[model samples]
Target: MKCFQLVRSVLDEIYSEIPLQDEAQKDKAIKDEILSLRSKYAKLLSSSRVIDYENPITRFSYIYSYVTSHANIVYNIIESSDMLCALMDSKKVSMTSIGGGPGSDLLGVIKYLTNASKSPTLRCNLYDRESAWGESWSDVDNKLENPFKISIYFQQFDVGEPSTWVRHVKYLSSDLFTMVYFMSEVFGNKTTAEPFFNNLFANAKKGALFLYADNNTPDFYNWFDELAHRNSLITIESTSKNFNVNYDEEKTDLGIYYDKFGFPKLTANIAYRICQKQ
Candidate 1:
């Protein structure tokens, strides 16, 4: 798997640098190619009867390390230590994660709090739809308890239907502590996301702190920022950083390995936005 991934990464780097009319054209072509590859892989995996589980490549330690390193980019850029310490000292925080991939974001925040103080107790209410990994939500919760050593509630909730889920989230988070971290799962598709955000803004209380990190794209950034401005939510900070591994120099193309159809390059910019509800 590592060999395949490395080869794929190299190929993707080469394909990405393939001459195009301009940057815009390059992005469009890559975007289209990514979609096409996704469809192709979906069919191939299904045919091979491995579609129900997380891709083997995604589970490799190196791949997760690469992902977590990117996640820390948001943590380093956002100055949440003081607020996290305050919340920990109080021993009460209503934190929720939307699309918390395998609970990495939740665990990262819990580690920050635990390391900052003396055995801080925290309340994390997680929300995520079923992930491709057959590892159910319970698996993530179990791993978190031993490391962070705190009380955590794991619940399967879909962010797209904020009406059904937001009320529960509000009830779970009814006091001086509120932090919401959401990721790519919600905003990747615009049509479904618009209503979800509308419901979220209406349901969320004032003074709530929100952190969203996702694959960067102009449309996602523009729409979310616009909504923040309209709702009086102050944008505390925003950051864009590349998460792609440089593979172009190897003169390879990973896309060709996917039975002629899987997205070869996993290049994505992890962009984060910190906001406070007014």
Candidate 2:
């Protein structure tokens, strides 16, 4: 199976793990959770409150609606950036994904590597506040069919509690760093999130490449720009574009879920940037 197909497989597996007994009850549960997540995001857009990803339904809500599109977005950005393309060709790649417990960030890099037919050993650290998110992608290596090995670690990070972030020094060694749709999630708590970014830029390896993709809005991009600016990260290329996944490239595997949740996010207006800490 292809790397992007692995994303769909993950969604299928997570769907099975939902706490529902039968078809009817599962349908009801999925619909309700999707609505609840939408309401929570609406509130998050307007307030400082953080959603509880530890809640199983909320977590599933985000994974179902977003993981595939997000993975696709990050893959596009990575494949287009010359520095990341060069990194993909390296013998090994070390990356830290901030708030990337949903698994999209790593999947994107896998997709890029798979398409390029370059299977470098992957060392990835996916950090998030919700420990529960780790279970969702634990089997990623099992799903990948490449010759190279992959190493994935999940580090608990709480944006509201900066201490959890400051104590971690190992992530500073990453050759690439990604923040995919993560800025807006903790935007209201910038005071807490800002320090982590500062420490990240201050200590990251000199040749690290940073990839950022989020909603095409200043509320998100401005924070990314400010961090890159103060840190003197050189921009490779930056633009806003409407990216759509080639849904037809893969078979229609989301049939049942589509009937319930309308459809997964196939397209998104995303602002993306690729920067190098030279």
Candidate 3:
């Protein structure tokens, strides 16, 4: 089986661990379990794939391949809304991306922000624990040719660890608009997202806008919806687009499910939330 299939299998087993409740508790028991699972997943991804970066073309082929399928739709969705553009451009904004995956999503957000009239001084930060496993991972220094020179910082840390966040919070402070985007599956059995968000908003300024984006997989979709409803964070925008599936069809780690019928083999189903600290 391919790497992603292995991930999917692990996820299937772990999915049952997430609780279903209108008001779920962020307990030590939950946090520890998720953290343990995250470590296992990290090891699995790192060991299974040997990323070919010797050739520039070969390195970009996968990224380019995925982008050609998903980027346009994601761009269009982001561009069509004034509220989202505002959220991205809020002055004194401090955004932290979790599981951002080599910074493609930030690149997309920065592209939109640069095109708009508001040239806000943005201090962006990206967080990930996968850097030790692969050199291809993203950080603050990862650059793209752009008109907007947004200052971005990358911190390598695991989202599963509560202690790692002490430095993260100190770096971000409490007075900035904080946004955390999860492009990958960050809601598995081992994730510290709930506590982080709970603590983050408690210390945030009143106008802080937090956005979390994840695929519409059954586990994540349910998790995101529950968090949004419980937290009083209104859904400013929610939509789906034609996205690409990263794993090959023949690879068979996970089935196409509903995607098999569509002309575009992959689709990016995204959800956005704009919240006021109350």
Candidate 4:
């Protein structure tokens, strides 16, 4: 499937269930909510606990702005990486996406697999603290079409709490683990977050793939790089670039909201790293 087609389909699915009365109303609501949530999300990146993602509207706002943008970036990263291509060629693949709310990473994976014409039986586990995201992602899963089987499991797991990490032990034995735009969110509480990441890398199966993508923040990139080094994960590839999104092409209220907020254009400075457990 073409990238834009996949995006349109996913956006359509999300928009259909947004519980809005009309397009204009939805656009205004999303725009207002996105502005408010963007401030809170920014605080979250800085480690402030001022925002609550438990609210459905907050999650919806995030989905409209960051999720679509991140999904596009992930698709581009996978499309351009030979390592990712080889990884997707497997007949059976398991992937885990930490902080993968509402299927952004999953959609990116699906787009890659479909375009590559590799019909691997895929099992994806999406872990997030907000359980409501599970419902939205399940809706997305049901809407997708694939030649082979794909199963998505949603878990309400908190990465900050060490006690909750054990429940994910079984799912950690995955072919690939993705942390898209997640590290920045947790980096604020490094004291607590470090142990979880340390344990994750230490316990992951040998030869497993790890994909880390986030904003082009030096601190965030350095934190993950340090963890990779400490865990002896071999860095296969890493790059930083501008991730631009054409808001005009968006077929949902997101586009309208962007235009309304004077963000007729959108671009993100992103960095990505690919590593393999040694």
What lDDT score goes with residue 213 in model 1?
64
TM-scores of the candidates are 0.57, 0.92, 0.56, 0.86
Judge candidate 2 against the unseen true structure and give its global Cα lDDT, from 0 to 1.
0.80
Q: After superposition, how far is residue 223 of candidate 3 from its true place, in Å?
A: 0.7
For 33-114, candidate 1 gives per-residue lDDT tens digits of 5554346433431232222213332332222223233334333443354543444566556666655534445545644553
lDDT of 4 at 121: 88
Clashes of each: 6, 0, 6, 0
Q: Write the per-residue lDDT of candidate 3 for residues 93-114, one digit (tens) a residue.
A: 5555555444444545554564
Arranged by lDDT with the best first, the candidates are 2, 4, 1, 3
Kindly indicate the candidate among 1 and 2 with the higher lDDT: 2
| Candidate 2 per-residue C-alpha lDDT over 122-195 given as tens digits, one digit per residue, 9 for 90 to 100 | 99999999898987777788876654689899988886677788788888999999999888888888887787
The lDDT for every candidate, in the order shown, is 0.47, 0.80, 0.45, 0.76
Each model's Cα RMSD: 11.6, 2.0, 14.0, 3.3
TM-score of 2: 0.92
Q: Candidate 1: misplaced stretches above 4 Å?
A: 1-67, 77-85, 131-149, 161-183, 242-268
Clashing residue pairs, backbone N/CA/C < 3 A, model 4: none
